[model samples]
Target: MASSGTPSLLQRVSGSMVVFLGLLSVLTSVRCDEQVPVIMWTSEGISLPRQPPPTAGHIVGHQQLASYLEKALNIGPRNVVLFLQDKMSIEDFTMYGGAFGNKQDGVFPNLEEALQSSSSSLVLPAVSWPASNAVIGQLQDQLETSPLYMDPETLSQLRLNASSPALLVFRLPYGTGSDLLSAKEILSGNDEVIGQVMSIMKSQSVPYTAIYTGLQPSRKEAASLSVEAGLGGGRSLLQARGTHRDRWRDRERQQRVKEKPGVYPPVEFKEDDRTCMLLWAKGLTVSILRNNRWEEHDLTPSTFGEGVSPKLHGSNCDKSKGRLVLNYENVLGHRSFKLIFVMSERHYKVSARRWFTLDAVELEYDGTKARFNGSRNIYAPAEYSYRCKSVTSFRWPLLIPRSSKDPANQWRVSFDDFQIQGFNLKGSEFSYASDCAGFFSPGIWMGLLTSLLMVLVLTYGLHMIMQLLTMDRFDDPKGPGISVPQTE
Candidate 1:
């Protein structure tokens, strides 16, 4: 309360103080926010000898790379924009990769041409820099003759923008000129392009990245056995050896049984019942081979601009009785190959039985739904593990039908992303359903709004009636009055 001139002065002073305190609180809050721990960003790059092989792993397969990135950058794949670079041959590039291969094709161009079209940074050729060196020399010479060249201004801006965490993939894609260093000699080379690549990155002023995917070691295994690797016609070496051994053992067993028939009743036995089946990921594309015709399932929509490849997921097959099954049709020229992978998804093919079913595909061990994308890549590797259904090593036993024309080519499926979720007492994946929250939660909000509208309508009607009655008594020219009430 204000008493007089003095009180008024106090009030004015207090009001100014309140405003100052509020501003100070806000500034302090902002200062505190800025003081929180920040991530120390670093940039690095990877240089591989050859173009990476195609990965049959599914969308979840990216998680393996993501894991490494997370460890290096403290950021996941979804949060970072990775720049993957490599060189490919003309034919292989266009046929396998969606990117255009030759400059003559006109539709696609080299890095220099691409820069021109996109209005991005220009790329210049640099001298060979050894991989061991931190930066390259003669950077100034590089800027003058590059097919696409970036000015000093553009380089500075890009460097600042790339200061955040990211990953870089470089390839000494050029053939060793005349040097014949095999894949085994991947890390060797004094004049390899990797050095130049690093130097160019520094001059451009982009943030640094770390080596992620590389030509370090192969995770795939090769299946090998002695009996003349053959086509549809080959010797059954394993079965033959087993049969011979059985015959020799039987002769001895029979003699004993004949001599001791009285001691023991003739023993009877039954054959063990077990089988194996093929199971791919659910919704995965399948190619059925019949009469030289192939029908594929789950075709990608053309509107997507690029098509995805068939994903290799965990198979949910009959695991109790026999070996797993697959055909060599997918192989271009090889009869047998190794499969190395991690068990992203694992199940009993059923809740209890070994016969795989759709139910297995729908649930994770913890009952979460998995989202699988259909795509392929070069650097990604299938995770390796010891689960019965995974491709863990190069040497695996695959049994094919004696007759290629056998009927019923049905493939069952279950899968894990190798990096995300799979394999448990009851398998399931963790799925994010944020969109559903808005659509579903809106119904409750709408209901509350409707209830509020109803209350407002009732209150307005009563207010309108009271206002009309008062107006009639006060403003009407001829209106009845309560004289008795006034006298009282």
Candidate 2:
């Protein structure tokens, strides 16, 4: 269909295409920085009633120790660099830079490689004073301010541009460091740092743990500080600044944490597989029971949450004579576990108000189970259904059991859902951070359920009416007409 006047396209390949190819050959390339292996120790001064921590406690000391050694012994400075102290070079003293270089002097690569060979940087600087207006003025004149410190308030913001696989170093300064390092007199102004530190640590990662150390004037001086001050062993001995020896010990513990399979709790699960439970004041017995049996279980949830599930597990005991007790440790909410019990030989009349005991592991009452779902629900999965309920503890509806003449019937009383939560740090998998679909507001869910129920009822009623109408319209003239039956 081409017109005769059209030119042959093959002969007219655009000269513009040729020009474009030439520009493609001239494109430039840029290189990205190579990442390096490192350990960054973030430091902060912990706030107790007294002053600050010594070396952010021992754990971080260990991490610093490991990073220190890795930089020294790794046989390559290009491999690992502790970014905190610019002067640090496989040392055990001073700041991380070469300050403690003697610790790794002979062990690590040459001094130059350790310094210049770093293709990447890892920071592990201990925190001193909050880089507040006061402290910033002091540091700004000396060392270059770290990017995190660009914002003057960053130090006050305890949780800032933090690094990962990161060690948070909390300070427990003795009176000396404060007087020596701090710009303020009495350093009482720095107390805000402690309050900020605690507020942030609680909601951070499970791997996120704290190490607290202190440096103080003297033992009696610290003891005089008082219990409300948050001192340990109630003395000033623990509140003193760490010397060189303290650093070494901290390093030792840290090395074990790394080389050894499980030293302390990292973000990962460790040997203890420790599971912490938030128990309530009412569940002292339950806490005692759990503590006694701690080793037997991997991680027992010592706390109860808002709602109880339909299926429940665990054991409870009724210590009080007429009172029904439910074990909840630090757990706030009314919903507790259900008790499942079998019928005994006696045909006792069970009252909903009366207390009965159900013993799974411990003893608790059956009817005593609180409705956690009224305002909140305590969620329990299927695996924890064993202690869901026990009957001997609480007064529940009575079910007739076999008499002496009859065979024994193995009966089970179940509390379908008992509201409780435990530390399941297995990451996702129904652990601390569950991806399970969330429930709607109780009122909203109730409305939805009611609407669906009404729909079903209406459909059922309409079906019956339609059938009756059909029968009436097609009734057999010779036979009796179909009659409506009472709806049950």
Best candidate according to TM-score: 1
lDDT of 1: 0.24
Writing each residue's lDDT as its tens digit, candidate 2 over 1-488 gives 01111223212323212111111112121000111112221112211121111221112232333333333222221111111211111111121112222434222122222222222212222321111101211211122221121111343454433232222233322233434333222222222343354334434422222212121112233223322222112233243323465456546645665675522311111112122221212122121123344211111233232222112212111222111222222222212222222111112355323222211221221111111111011223312211222212122422222222111122222232222222322321223322123457557898999999999999999999888743335667899987668895
| Predicted candidate 1 versus true structure: per-residue lDDT over 1-488, tens digit per residue | 01111222223433212212212223322321111110111223321122111121111122232232334333211112212122211222222212222334222122222122221111101111111111110111111111112332343344434433322223332232344333213322312333444345656645443221111111111112111221111245235434765456546655664686432211111111111122222122323355676654331221011222222222222212111212222231222211212122233443543211111111111101111111111011111111122211112212121122211122212221112211111111122211112333657998989999999999999999878743334544577654546565
Clashes of 1: 29
Model 1 ranges with Cα > 4 A deviation = 1-69, 75-160, 163-167, 173-191, 212-277, 280-488
lDDT of 1 at 364: 17
Question: Candidates' TM-scores?
Answer: 0.24, 0.18
